[model samples]
Target chain A: MDYKQLQGRLRSNILKMHHGAGSGHIGCSLSCIDIMAAILKFKNEADTFILSKGHAATALYTILNETGAIPDEDLGTFYKNATTLPAHPAPLKYAAIPFATGSLGHGLPLATGIAKANKLKGNDKISFVLMSDGETNEGTSWEAAHFAVANKLDNLIAFVDCNGLQGFGNTADILGNTASPKLWEAMGFEVVECDGHDIEALMQAWKKLAANKNGKPKMVVASTVKGKGIKEMEDKMEWHYLPMTDAQYTAAKQEIRAGYGLEND
Target chain B: MRKHFSEYIERNLADREDFVFITGDLGYNALEGVAKKMGPRFINAGVAEQNMIGVAAGMASQGFQVLCYSIAPFVVYRCLEQMRNDVCFHNLPVYIAGNGGGYGYGIMGSSHHAIEDIATLSGLPNMQCYIPGFVEDMRATMDEMFARRRPAYLRLGLGKNLPADMQLVTGGTQTVLTPEARLTILSQGPVTNNLIAALAKSDKQNSIDVFTLNTMPFVTLPAALATSIATTKNILVIEEHISIGGLGSSLALLVNEAGLPLDKFISLHAEGYPNGLYGSQAYHQQVSGLGEENILRVINSYF
Candidate 1:
């Protein structure tokens, strides 16, 4: 798959879903779309992915729909009454999702275990756990970080959607200088820094980490702007929880079309 | 109890290919054999209880009968939300073996004690609470847990004081020391040892029956317990845990639901914090009103 095209489509779908669903994490979801696109590009049948920052269910649902793991029609029912696609990701209801995660700091530990299980079974499926910058503040995430290294879980690759903002405030304000790359490196991870919105850079990082086998887990600290595709909501805190209004949705679509060179409808 | 549990794990690992044991850097002397035998299957998840539970759930998700071993407080209290979300909510077959139930690690101070574990863990849905007072009970309960393949918490008290005639009742009660008595005293774990000793020394030893329940958070009362409750005027519950949510509270609920009337339904169990008591398990038991003398006094008050 052409990751740039997929990123554009994922961004468009995310905007539409936030507007249609009437409630979703639009900004944070948009921040990780390109990173997720790069992952989906290289993700094989053996590979499994977990979205630890589960408020971005719309982004994951859109990507799954694009990948054909989930039906396209189900995307329309996003966040609607009696819909399997709720505001948070429920993997049991959707086969594309592997683990149900919304609570912060759970994804890495669960992913570590999954990688461990795969190792025990002699399966080489690389378990990918995508977390948020704010999610790193949880103590459990650090525990998993330490455990992953101690167990030599080289098959696990963690992606930090370093959007810089959290639920309450900027991650810098809440947790000063969390510096995920340095933190992960100190915890014995082969840390890589990248522009999260740059699909080529993310794919390159994924390739290097997937092939590297130095007995240390890999972490890609992808620096990103919250609500990256749209100008109005970029790095704004309110967009974390707010769905796009009709005007905001129209503006976002036009911005994406203009920036990504999509044919204007 | 730890010795038998470790022996069982070692024996099972020889045959069961799917069994995985995880610990939070605990089981100092007891787990080395299991670790050596199982190799990579036995994982010490460090002191991180929350991550240990998540790891167990992850292993269990892939057709593994995972066992998480730790002290009662560390496993139950430290990682309750993980157990609820990762294990119980998903209904994974993860057997959490808590080594020090109640005041089993009493001299290690209040932090090591696990008095409120029963109350906290019992409230979770799809969870079975098992308190094994003897090695036989541990074997029987482990077999039942393995057969059932559900989420269970096995409370392992450190003290090994098994009553000579303590019957291994599967998912029910056992009349250990005294049977066919009009007055019944019920409890779980090694606390039953004190009850047994008290009953044996009492003048009304034949009149006061001593029964031990191996499992709790159960639906229906065992026929023997129900029958005992029907005939008894005085029923006393002595647990090493707190009064609110341990065996005492569960039995009260059963008695109320069964509509069994009695002159006295006394619950002699611990209540509130230990106030930084760093003494032996015996001292904690005495202060908590679960000592031999306290048991005899409560029995004499009614019987």
Candidate 2:
């Protein structure tokens, strides 16, 4: 599959969902679209992925819609009461989702447990959890990190969308002095750094981690720009909660098409 | 009883593939043997209650019967959100077993006390709360809870003063000491022993009925309990927990709602947190007004 084209389509679908609902985490969703696309390529009948940075549910829903894991009809009811995809990844709404995670700091522990269970049961399928950089601030996240290391969960892989901006402000200002990659390294994880928007680099990182026999949980710090596809909204914190007006939606659509060279394809 | 409970799980370890015992570094004297016996199935989660709960929930989600155990306060208080969200919300068969109910860890001070756990856990959806009054009762419940295999919370006491031949009740209240008495004393765990001792001292042991309630979140009074209430309009509920939302409060509501003729309803329970009082379990019980003398006084007042 052409992953770059898939990323563009997911970004477009996410924009449409946010515009249709009139409310959603557009910036966070856009930042993790490429990472989600890359990880979806690894998902098979047994492997599972948990979106710990659940504010980016739109991006995951869009990917699931594209990959045929979820019915395309469910995409139209995003963030509406008419469908179970109500702003966060609720597994009850879609059984294809392995577990529900909207509250921050819960996803890593749940993923660690699942990975540990699979290891105990001798299942070879890998379990992946994608989280936000700002989510590392929660104490439970650190507890789960320590737990994953102590248990030696070699089957577990975590990806952090390092978008630099959170709901409050830049992550650098809110979380003082501790870089997420270094922190994971200090906690005894085999850390990998990659360009968040580079699908090829992400695939390579995943492959390298899966091949390593070092018996440590792996964390990939995918450095990304929030609102990657839009010119005016990129890296802007206000866009985290901002809904697009009709004019802004039209302009975003035009910009995405022009940027991806799909305007006259 | 803690040792016995662990031994029960240990004895059945080889037979059951679905059972997994996890602790947050608790069960110092009770669980070491079970841990050694169960091998990979026994997890010591290392003082991380929140993570341990999530881990239990995750394992249960995959069809494993998980028991997340620790001291009373740490097991329920620190990780309640995970229990409510991850375990109860999914309705998974996760058994949250807290080792010290009420003042079980008394001299360890307020941080260790779990005087209000019943209220906290009972309010959650799909949670079955069990406070076992004797070692026999705890043994029976351990089997039944795992047999049914649903979401549950087991509040264990300090394992003292167990009656050898008392017939235990599983799903509702059981009148243990007195059968055909008019004034009934409703109590829980080892606190019932204290009430029995107090009543024995007053020579009213046979005249006064003592009933124990170990099953909750199935708070409906069974026919036997209702029948016990029918013979007696005067009821005194004594629990080691605080009165608010404890057995006392719940029984009051149950008795009143059941429309049993009631001349007097009294609950003898700990008032609230035992603030700044550091002493033995008995001393803490005394400070909370759960002492035998105080309970006898309350029961007398009700009559």
Candidate 3:
């Protein structure tokens, strides 16, 4: 299947995984699926991206499975005791992952360090770091921002998944919302805006902005509804982690299977 | 120690590629010439202490030996968790230089005073705490700290310069007032000088040995030295930090760990200040009972 088909299937699978576990950040994870797909398509490399905002791993693990980073049997044991896929998406819990996740605002600076090492060692592989809009509340994020721009680390790309909700409450109430696009622009980044769910649009933006190898860092402000696929989940804060019930799970599966024409697993 | 350590930084920059000097956007006015000579290795991480520490940690992970410069509290307390987790957890052979210890920033008020650092730092595990007394001790401790690829906290003083060849280092003991008394007094950094001067003014014919603890995580205080100190009716611990969790306490813990006996453990620590202003490096000792008179009083109390 093409990238678009894979992206859609992954979004559907994210909800299904969260259904099995009875818990997940379905909304935020669903929105970032397409963005992850776009970057994977553009980079065309073996090393995988790391989710700095690890809370969104429900969807991330789902995509990793769809891409064969995890086998179908392995996906069944997510978040269970003795299972590698703990709640916050520990990287390489499965073979293909890179590093552990969960603590937000850490991945970009780390990725920048990795990129710098590659540059010094004369390696051409790239690393991507994805974070939620709420993770920007940390000063370390700004510190990393300044360092990356100043250091001229061009190989690193960071995505601020602008789902607009933080753990404590709404992002605006806690830190206040001003334009993120303008903020990144002032920080000396090549900032681009795109539909977070549109794999095609996101892929285009990634190629245009990030493909340039000559030392400018790129950030994509991916605007997306928190819960994208399921009917009641879109834009609902209640669905951030509260899982769909068995009845709701059966209903969701029926809807997904009906529309996609798949043999129900 | 300042001149010697600064000189080492100067020479290293000329010799090694990865060695770098980082400052707190303060206190290079004294070493302008050396800084100019060692331009590439020097980095001023600015007043943002936490950010500077994280930056240092990041740079260190890439095989750079980052010598972070700042006042004691700025280095130790303000970015405490970051220092503990990011720097020590990674064990990235970076050296931290705390220029003003205890009340070094005496004029700046309590905020600048690093009186609480020793308590917090000594327990961080796998790190060395160097509380240098004389300028020569600075070289001895720094030479060891820099040579080993481990994290270290160097608590320094803005005190007097010593003779160039003065050889007492981390491993060796010195004759500060020319050992005349049988009783021995042990202290580190500026406190050592203050303790010596206190004994002289008291005018007792003395054969006391003044051993400066240059390297900390002080291994079992030597048996001969412990016996010498035990022979004395008094053992005084003087530090410019808080009476709680400072040098005296560290020594006490070391003595306990070594199962050595102490006749007396006297601590001269914070008593606020003559003026309430913080970060006053000079008046710190006088105000906090680390002054010569107070130290003498603690010694005389035992006699």
* Most accurate candidate by lDDT: 1
For model 2, the stretches where C-alpha displacement exceeds 4 angstroms are A177-179, A263-265, B160-166, B176-180, B203-207, B273-275
Better of 2 and 3 by DockQ: 2
Residue-wise lDDT of candidate 1 within B280-299, one digit each (tens)? 88888888788999888888
Cα displacement (angstroms), candidate 1, residue A216, comes to: 1.7
- The CAPRI class of candidate 2 is medium
Candidate 3 per-residue lDDT over residues A86-114, each given as its tens digit: 78865325644554557665666556655
Better of 1 and 3 by DockQ: 1
| The candidate that achieves the highest TM-score relative to the unseen native structure | 2
Better of 1 and 3 by lDDT: 1
Worst 10 residues of 3 chain B by lDDT: B161-170
lDDT of 3 at B144: 81
Clashing pairs in 2: none
What local lDDT score does residue B209 receive in model 3, on the 0 to 100 scale?
A: 56
lDDT of each residue in A1-265, candidate 2, tens digit only:
3566667777888998999999858999999999988888665657778898888889988888887888878888888886878888775556557777888888888888888788778878788889898888878878888888988988889999998887698888987624377878999899999999999889889878977868899998999999999988999998888899999999998888878756433
State the C-alpha RMSD over the true interface residues for candidate 1, after superposing those residues: 1.4
TM-score of each: 0.93, 0.94, 0.79
- Fnat of all models, as shown: 0.46, 0.50, 0.09
